[model samples]
Target chain A: MIIPAKSRLWSTVAVFAVAVGLTACQTTGGDAYRAPINAAKTQTADDPDKDSGAPTDVSGDSVARDDGDSGITGSIDDYRIEDLSPGERPDISSDEASVWMIADRAERRAANAGNAIKDPALNAYVSDMVCKIAGDYCDDIRVYIVRVPDFNATMSPNGMMSVYSGLLLRARNEAQLATVLSHEIGHYLRRHSYQRMKDTIDKTNGLAFFQVFTAALGVPVVGSIATIATVGSLASFGRDSEREADGYGVLLMARAGFSPHEAPKIWENLDAELGDTPRSRSFFYASHPAISERQTMLRALADEVPIAGGGPGRIGTEEYREALSPHWESLLADEVSKRDYERTERLFDALIADGFRAGAVYYQKGEMYRQRGDEGDEDLALAAYHAATQFIDAPPEVFRARGQIFQRRGLNVEARESYAEYIRRNPEATDRKMIEFVIGGLGS
Target chain B: MKKLVRIAALASVLALAAACQGYTLVKGGSPVEVGNAMKVSPERSWSKLTSGKYEIWTVDGPILQQILFASGVEDGEKLFPTDAQTPKTLPEFKKGMTELEITELYRDTLVQLGGTQFEIQEIAPKTIAGKQGFRFEFTFATKEGLQKNGIAEAVLAEDKLYFVAYTGAKLHYYPKNLPDAEQVMGSVEIL
Candidate 1:
């Protein structure tokens, strides 16, 4: 259930605030933007606006292009963050320390999270990919792969990151995943949430602070979806920061030797998935940068960043499929349960086009139509089910579906034949008795 | 100190705002009809809330403990209510659906309700209200990672669905209220 944006506005005052001492430094746009964590008091549980930074960019003069500390005179690409984490955090503010403690708490919670995908092989596979992308900072960031069926990722200020299972289902290739991870890493490198928190505390105090802080941070506009999970962009940072992070993530992907061109399509595909729904999907919409703007900016950045081998970057489609397909059924079930018809329709169509799991995808498409029971959806469901039965992996449920439709239409003979086939293919089916009873009623 | 106080005060305001929801009382030893389809006699008192097609009862609250009775769902109607604002549509109950499909519907409904994990421990035939129905036991977790456990009974009579489920936090609440839930479930009668 989506809480109204207005009511949830105050929830983002400060989920986790980090204070980093900035030093004048010079760097490349490809470099990450992490400042050391110091003492700060932030992160409130149920902070409505704290969790997600919507995908949309805030376009206006309110977004400060040059938000860097003093003497940081350079294009965003050339901006440098001296050290994201230093050995000693001596200058701890009570606020920052409290933030750290809570961040630690959030991390501990992630460690035992029930939705965690428990497959050692899948975990190892993803961890290895994250390791390759993380480089020297890999040790600081802890990754959690959760089974939430939404396209979201989150990086806590304490170096905790969560990758939702739906992200794996949505991303067609390794490169796409890399693009998002690199972006989240870019957020850590950039320290967007901390920066936003710092900006908030710098300006206000008292009840007015509580009232206006979330609004000023642009948290209210996109805070409604923070529970879905988030990373740098999901936390509702200023558009300037989000824009920079988006560019940085693509550049990082390009530098890491994954195909950066796949970056923009993440938003494009998500936009299609959202498909005129009133719900604001925070990761890529209704927040900071617009999808078209992000796509254009990301595409330009992708073109700007040069790859190492000078050949097109690696998409790693085969590697991604091999690593994730074992858990594909569970992931797809969660996806279907979401019941976002347009989103699943788009996703299934794309999967079919990619030849990822044509039979399963078709069958699921039929299931969606059949389950929804909207006008004329049954005919569409039957057609897809028929198409599904042609492939090797088509489930036995397809026959059951056909039988139900036929029985409802008074085609008892056809229904009986279909039920017989369903029972014939799977002798130990869980619903065998029920099917048999129905077939008994539809005698020859 | 000043900043800490400010943040704490803001939290208090939020808590006050959240406490607006009120619950009705279900008296002990009294037979109660829920959702216009079933009646049950509880051994203890509890708080209750009507959810249009169902009724939810709780001791500490829904997060800690809950008993759900969703009965009389007709063919082509949803087993659960839809949030008008969310674009998502819940799957409908159909005629001739089997116990296994019903189990799937429950699982999907939980998933849609933000349950992160569910593992069914058992599904077996059981007698309910003088008729053979299905009973299921399972463990689950919410999005926040809190573990939970539940026991449920379901019967399909005249193509109308009758279901009762009791769920609680796995730590202490489940064990604490399992007996209470069982008693209520045992007293269930189709009205």
Candidate 2:
């Protein structure tokens, strides 16, 4: 927990300086920071510390109130689609423009420095999906698919949207994917980032200013960590923004002819995946509305606006599965590597329920069981691997896994046969010499 | 807040002073004993660092390319230092671990070190220190976005794990030093 002090000091100083500069130069007309139209609809205020397993009585209540404009009010039903065309840029103050410029530069630098997935077809597919929901605002937003294995996405004030692969992997269908994308787009359209920044600066007195400076430096991790540290109190402010975004996102999906039910289903799946794990309180979940709360509110909203045709509308599950087919193994591998056994097991169960990529799902389940190595885990692993082999697209590693288990049990003949099959299937296997050596020993 | 600032400033000064100390130079074509359990011969000279439990060696620089030797790590002992009170937990080396389980231990270690995007490219049985062992190839990206490639070999002898890992930046350093690492691994001998 002891971070490098030098880096922390630099980050704190940098953020503080930027916040002060932005505050002094503020000249924006109109309420750029508006309270959520649906604040009353949200049952409880967001308390990240409470959700994160920390005591709720932590100090800094004053900092929590600085989340920009809290007086501007309306209901979720009061929102009307604005003129979001590329030609009709939203009004911005000079100070807001400066923040946007910095964000634009940082995003461009990040695009070059970070591992961006360069799959044109995948990018185009995602962009098209976002456009369907974005309407006229589609041209104002550019999508960047990053290669990180964490379930999150963000939209900066500069109109750059990053979709992490983890989110894509977790999403079961196009509707689910659209739900997340539209939520981020809601943040963009509402100008939440700008408002949040202003609030942070105003509340901290001087401590929060360093956050803005670090963000401007474009040292990715430092800036991000600093923002998280200083912006802890801003979670209440963020909760309001998130609630607003959720409302907006549902409207977007329903209008775009996608099933709104998928929105809540995303959270339901996530809730199940998290179960009672400590990760339920992790930053990813903490910064957003509680999953159960989101699921309930979204369900209510979806019920209010039933699909026009009475049909389920476009779930796009088949198309989504096909599009992500090439990346499935790698995505699944990333999930398995996290070693969160319960979460991974639930994920595999969900995938199996969908009946897509059953072979790979079975294989991954086997891997989880094998890695857990509990008393009865070996039997479970063997059963899962055996099931995997029945499917056409089962990974070749299934044979090797079987061979190892048999070898452990001193079933030499079975192990040798399994190893031989593995060698036959994977002629260019990197561990061919080792497998061959095992076979040689079995012969003796 | 002021107290935090002072403590941080003091820590920074100490860190700077520590960095000023140079590494111990290891001559090429010389045999080296790693920890108390294993020895290896290096064909080329390297710089050695004794920071924690492992003996670290670097050719170009630790950031670009390095080798780690962990010898005689006992049961319930952490491979790296960690604060007991921290929420993050490090995996410990345990006796009676299968090859797959041992690899998982290494994977967990890498994750603790901020290698979130770690992938095992290959794992197979191999001979190390003239005894049955396992070797694994992996790739990972650091939090700072540096992609790394690594190869590791380990054996459990006398109920303790003896391990060596070579890692380098995937862009250029990995391919450049892979042969030298292979040669070093080949020369390993358990006392």
Candidate 3:
């Protein structure tokens, strides 16, 4: 495929991102620059050029080294989360203090950001989840649920963590959400971002490696990836850092009474969403190399840590469903607005499979097709809308949409039924009079 | 390493070329046709980008303040350019979109275009282009962390869309230029 120069430049950066000699800053694609922002764990262990259809290589053997190791390390059991408290403060006039200052400023801005999900109920639920997984340091972290429509989360050194709306939409249950949260918190506890700042920068090659990303941020061409990487810790977080976070995430899940088994499923869903993007392959970024290996790795870690109560861990699918159900429509609306057909479809399919608010998820799925209006998408949209009406949570807009489609198909009777249903369901609709006029125009 | 350096150098040169897109001066009181349909008379000189169906005019840099005029948006076209080849996730303008959906498309388009912390403070019915339309007010922060406020007027007539929006840094630029933007848009004439 003849990729556009702008895209080609970014692919060049993502694929051939000038290597940070110490770590090879494996740049993945858009989603890699996003969630769990490691794309977090898997990089193809083999030559990147040889990597394609990278997800299926899930065998435990495809593991890439953390730093300079020859192979995957056995017994991640030795990893220790750093001790931290809510009362801790960075020393004044120190490098760590400067990072904290920048983060604090970013936090203040993020706190007031318009894109933040301001619903008190939703914010409280996410904060409680962070506390559950974070243990003693829970008080140290402040969570911001950004309304960005991508699967990513990041915690700045100053304890400010942003969980994107896309991640919430993608994660099927609470455990999956906890997985990402714990992973970010792990990065925080480990001081990974600080290490990256002091260790990665100042290194000549690393500086050179980051220059393109820095330039991309100001300019538009390749900046989308750089944009995510810059704010989301994409530029700084490395491979081993991801593995460690994954380990901590699993442990935290087990500790918080969530099934650690759900942890790796995040990657499985990500691979499904990303499909054949370069970020998924070894060609570039080599960010997400083997899916099953990481899954296996996560499973192994989960197996090692027993849930506290042995009650199969609190999967909490219902509670998670209930908490997010109220906000799914808005969250999915943001997700759908990205207009990535295949990925959005995958997300919908996952939501459907989860069976939580099927009406809401299917309604957005229909809207996706309706907005794209591609060939045969009309029929697909109609089918989706029809399916959505079967559930209680479908928005009133679906009937109006179906009414329009039916009217277009010259099925006035069906149109009237759909339109009437819309009016019945939404009596207070601002456009009620308009719908009534449209119905009158349709005739009896 | 050498091969990568060569590519990076090529990327820099291309980036420079891309960045140097010159702007033309739209002198005060000059009636300029925008988006091949609407004609507006600016009350004062402004800098306008000299390309594409989407027209943007600025007094200070665009990061601080700008006026955007989008006209003749037909079915299946997006309101703003979808920068980069990521996805068609940017909302598209379909024919027969209701005012509510249109406002949503504009808001979503802005967010997808990288404005964050967005909120529509108010949206109410009004008149634009001698037809029944709508106007709305919103506040958002740019990726660069500058807070901004915006006002827009739009109407969909005969399966085409005409929109005028002015956005500026919320503190001073937005309030200072509010009158000029209003007068400029107030002079809009659809051809």
Best by DockQ: 1
Q: Per-residue alpha-carbon lDDT of model 2 for A216-287, expressed as tens digits? A: 543222222223322222133366677777887887887888898898988888777777767445644545
Which 10-residue span in candidate 1 chain A carries the lowest summed lDDT? A13-22
Predicted candidate 3 versus true structure: per-residue lDDT over A1-444, tens digit per residue: 333444433322221111121111122222223222222224433322211112111122222324555244635565666655555878997766756765675576567665777899999999999999888888898988877777678777778888888788888789989988988888888776666545433343443234334333322112122222224342235566667777777887788899888888888887777678553343324443266777888888877887868878877778887898787888887777766688789778977987888898898899899777779998999999999999987899899888877876778899899989998998877656656765776865
Evaluating just chain A, the predictions reach TM-scores of 0.74, 0.77, 0.77
True contacts kept of each: 0.10, 0.08, 0.04
Cα distance off (Å), candidate 2, residue B100: 5.4
lDDT of 1 by residue, B1-191 (tens): 23433433443443333322335799998898888789889989988766566777878766667787888888877655544322143457777776767877777667655565777776767789888787888888866567888888999888899988888778898899999999999998998
Assess each prediction's global lDDT (C-alpha) against the native. Answer: 0.65, 0.66, 0.67
True contacts kept of 2: 0.08
Q: In model 1, which runs have C-alpha deviations exceeding 4 angstroms? A: A1-90, A94-98, A207-231, A271-288, A309-311, A410-444, B1-37, B40-66, B74-101, B119-127, B170-187
State the weakest 10-residue window (summed lDDT) of model 3 chain A: A15-24
Candidate 2 deviant stretches above 4 angstroms: A1-76, A83-93, A112-116, A147-150, A219-237, A277-293, A303-312, B1-13, B51-53, B75-89, B96-108, B116-128, B132-140, B175-183
Name the lDDT value of residue A367 in candidate 1.
Answer: 82
